[model samples]
Target chain A: MNRDRRQLVLMLMPYLVGLVVLVLLPAAATMAMAFTETDLIATSRFLGAANFVELTTDPAVQAAVGNSLSYLMFSVPLRLVIAVGLALLLHRRARGSGTARAAVLLPGAVPELAYGLMWLWLLNPIQGPVNQFLLLGGEGGRTALGTLPPQWLTDPEDARAGIVLMSLFTIGETFVIVLTARLALPPEAYELAELEGARAGQVLRRVTLPLLAPVLAVLVLRDTLMSLQASFVPTLVVTNGGPPPYATTYLSLVLYQDAFEYLRYGYAAAVAALMLGLTAVAVLIQWRLLRRWASHGIVGAGAQRPGN
Target chain B: MSWHDPGRRRRAYGAVAVTALFGSPLLLLLAGSLREPGQPPVVAPPLIPEDPGFAAYHQAITHGDLVRAAANSMIVAAVGVPLSLLVASLAGFALTQLPRRLASAVIGLSVLAMMVPATALLLPRFVLFRTLHLTDTLVPLIAPALIATSPLYPLIYYLAFRAIPADSYDLCRLADLTPMQTWRRMALPQVQPVTAGLAALTFALTWSNLLDPLVYLYDRATFTLPLALRALAAMDPHNQPVFLAGAVLTTLPTLLVIGVAQRRFMHSYGPEGAP
Candidate 1:
């Protein structure tokens, strides 16, 4: 028994070192730094929630927080709706549908930075084809990146809209996840619905949607946390978080600027901790709500294992 | 044959039209890159310009720091992918082998790390790397893989490993294989599909990542393709064709990689499994 314990401890040694050096230490450092005020050159003085107080009252932080929340409110449901609709529409095994699905998903595989840059040019207000095409319809002469030209990165209203729209193109990841779940649905359930002479939409609502709800929730929670990161490249390139008071500043970008650019290590650490707290709360809620929906029965049928 | 039937023919025509319409955007994007700026934007022009010069490609090769960045990226990826695979497989295997309590904690931590957006790690990681003197080198970028802290690859490998049965481990042990031998001769073969999937994913993540290198590397010459492309975009946002050209160059490798990997992916991740 002693030998077994030793062996087990030995096995865990690497993980422990890794956890301490990579995760725990950083977490501890960030937590401690949150209470202090230090630039790179000097020792930090304990500030005792002064930073948090400032964070609460600062209009920039407030706008950032509001923008993030509003972004979540809009993007999550919109992505869920569009992803499910697209998955349902394209999940068929018809000729060339798989290829079509692959093509649509190609956008997701492209690097986020590359895709962001591509869209930056493609959505340019004056020169971009998107706006040019929009103008052809004579829709009040508003360009796609004009004062409110679906400005995916600038105007506050349009920034939220743009983030959501940009997310729409990357639905390949969510689409594939949902597609697997949709395919895994027992054919018998659909067969019964078909026998009942149910319409497609009815079967989708009653059978497909209900069964896939768990995966949908997972996707929503996952994307919400992800978009909370706000994809730095897009925001950085598209808006530069600009125009005034930095409306598009995500928690990560703010942290990055604080730590690296300004060398306010402590402030950056505080931002990191806040972001961590936010994700933790969101994740906890998701875990509690999503436990029931996780029953997708693993994909491959095989010998049973001890722990999932 | 369907011409005699209006409804069938109309549906067929509609399918064709939709395919063409949907396909046109991608095609136009590709076609637009090839067109010079002086040409009228509306007209469908040559697939290759009249000059058909390799100017963009040449510029990308000669003037751009693409080769070095590509080298750095490859080095990072080559080292990082295997490191991630090994760490994930080890933790995954041990989690299955260990007592219930330890396993749960391990799994919990892994899942928690996976769920946290990688952006959250940037500040902490930059600070950590700075202290270690690993910042600015490939180590900071690559070493994250060794710990399975790469938010993307670790989750992918964990899912893949989970799909494998515990019996595979026992089978290798019973065959008198050493742990290393077992990994090579048995477990590796069984998880080939997942390995391929994770490999592609690791490549995608490494190749496309702009944040880490941007933070760590100060010199423009050290920039990866994505970083270089971003730099190019910043230099001249108004030069539309130049941006497209850079985008295409940046996109080419991954596109080719996906084309090749898609077959393996299709086989491994059946139409039924998650990508």
Candidate 2:
């Protein structure tokens, strides 16, 4: 009713417009598309439940869902441990941390397409430098991608591992955020622990780990959601979601295949909508679990100065 | 702190060994790219090639689509970053100044936006752009970026603005400046470091994006750098050397940008309240 209130509404208008157009509208369209059977062609009919039925009954969809679960199982813990270890190493600035950080971060900057291609070659069953070095040109020498490379891009177990390995290279964005959280911790806390004759491990346990827990939780939540929609580049470069007809098919890959490959716009939209729903659930779970950490990391910086 | 300390030295050596191990993949990439087909494969001796030639780089450069893609990428980034900065700064300033409950809601929504992967948005965005007659053009590519609608840049700017002391805004108000003027004169200067960091990242993202143009654009003439590399890869799957070379060329500008941005981040993290 007053000037401040009026001013607030006026200022918020632009952002509100953006939200409607950019976020809300597209999301709504996806939901609507999920319910139909239009192939991006002339006429479309409402085929509610039919698309949902197929999505659930489809064996390829089941395998993809299973592989995605396996991927989360392997990738999350692997990345968390590796990321924390690397962060700790860089945190101490032990000779070459800067350069190490930069190098590690370089992979994150690389597009998925590039990284996928690199892996496609690196994991190549024959003559890949990785397999070659491992085998040392003996009778055991064979292309890892061909002989022992696991069906990473194609087989269920291997495809999951492949996804994890591909993702391993791009931990930089998370590493950076975690580094920010680590650097933000009060050095005096570590200083005091040292003065008290604490061992390095003790200091890490007592001081660093608790301080970093919040950031790590935030990183996990963010990455999990991002991982759900992971497709396009990886699919294109490696398996193309093939071999057993549909071993490595993720929801996004399925959507792409349906839309671009099969011209099944209605089916693609349905898949897209499901993926969006999963993403939403992931975000909700993250918020419920990590809201305290997110708030403290962002807003409680000054208030938590006692640790200083 | 002393180099004479055996413990410190041991830790330093430990760090180096770990880094060398972790960093080997990138090195392996370089070495593998350089090894000529049919040559005896040796992982040791020199990580550098015996001849140390740039044949792969030469081929990558001469690829017809690459140069044009680079130009297109530059244009896309050059236009995208500033537009995002302006809109994000405005929205961030407004959001930060709002009432506590309202601000939390906005922040929550934005965080939710960030949590949803960008890939999920692609399909609807493509259809929407097509309906609007903007799909084949660069307009759809740049439009979402023009608003502070993107989660990544806006989120960074929001955090940066929030980090600045609120009293500065109060001081501006006391000086008789309007909110817009206050943002431009006071808040904008403070957030410059954050903007610069975001600028580098935005540029890198724009340059390396492979999917958007590949799907949206109808012609090779509009291809971005990553798409150019993808085209090359599709053309020759056997030439791992050429693929690696394209990857290198694609990543060079990104490395430079990250190099410049890291200094700002380091400075920001130096001797401060983590808050």
Candidate 3:
């Protein structure tokens, strides 16, 4: 290497070491410990896929996987759609637009613990503004239209929906990224749509959505990966994994409780391994779905542009 | 809003409505915190307390050890964010300067590391820190600074630095500046927006990080703001007002910093998207 290249390497050394020590080594340990039985105190003995075998039959693990996937099913796509919608709606200059942007970011700015606590208060069955709004014109915990209030704490499906609802408002980061991307689009494209006298719905469906597809695809994958672990604090705080039968148990919470609470470090390592596997599967599924869409969307958008 | 046509008029309505919907939670937080401590969740309690007071905030501050926790959090953010920014910028600038084969390898490793689920690191990192006898100290909490809080940061920096016109690099080389010098004097200033954004993000992440402190901190004095709030949340269910006060205290600093920084870097993406 040349002298200058060596200097650059020197600068890279610290972060590289940090990556190896903090992330990679622990990752490898998780892989290795998945086959062992230890609790950070005992000498681990290799049990050779026994943890995996147990994991296959572990009902808690299965429920957690289901809960996590169900959350992703609802949250990831909804967050993206709402983020895109908010970006499109408020990205343009208007009165209260700046505050509107901050409002979207507000929930996300709060710490996870605080945010979870806020949701805990907000999802309170009787006094929460959510239920209060629902119960406006009626009494007995029923809405004006007589629908039952969502029991965010006790009911299994309602707990799941509550978690999903909590996840919805924190689309701030996604909203910002989408807003930036929205504002950055070549205005000429919009001008062309205007010259073509395209209606708002058509312009949105064709021009905006297709053009934003690439960024949205990347965000979808990112959000998918994050949502796998994002429910840890909220689930722990709000529902504490449910009214019964582990309704809202997520992988991160499961992993934490197993390792820390139950002192099953090795088993938790197994759970961690399970989480990694699920993440891979989730990403693969999303890639398959979005890869087809991104390519087609981009090509279609380009063709729809005036020059093309 | 008053002058623009139907589109702007509609946008104004939408903006106001969205703000109301999105902003209600925080508003509720303020209202709830103003209530008397230990008030039960009554069906149809007034949205604004009839007799709002500072009692909850006072109880939260005195009872929750929040002042101490806030100081610890400030310390962590102070130490962690700059270190993270430095490590990330250096590594990112280095990536842009490294030979192509080496750069690609490093970039690939970063992405792979970034892809590893954070939960998977919990047990092993805990054990690692325990083995080093660093578990109870604030060091493990700040150790994430070494990774720039997230592996993605360096790559973000790399993208920003690489966007600088090649002639800037050429100019540096013509001046015979060392890579570090060029990175410090040239590359750094050019990517101010990225740096500002990343700093806000890093500080927020470091400040709000609960997982690390949850695993590592046992002592109340050592707890960061989020962990302290978690402790406060464990109180009697009726004491909701105190915890809400705690939440508000926890969120204020992060909100102000990001709010201030967002106006600077977030609104403009210069040159690329102009009409």
Top candidate, metric lDDT: 3
- TM-score of every prediction relative to native: 0.85, 0.87, 0.95
Displacement of residue A120 (Cα, Å) in model 1 is: 1.2
lDDT (C-alpha, whole model) for all candidates: 0.64, 0.69, 0.86
Give the candidate number with the greatest TM-score. Answer: 3
lDDT for position A299 in model 3: 36
Model 3 chain A is weakest, by summed lDDT over 10 consecutive residues, at: A299-308
Ranking by lDDT: 3, 2, 1
DockQ, per model, reads 0.33, 0.38, 0.63
Model 3 segments more than 4 A misplaced: A294-308, B1-5, B269-275
TM-score of the A chain in model 3: 0.94
DockQ of 1: 0.33
Enumerate residue pairs that collide in model 3.
none
Q: Residue A103 in model 2: shift from native, Å?
A: 2.0
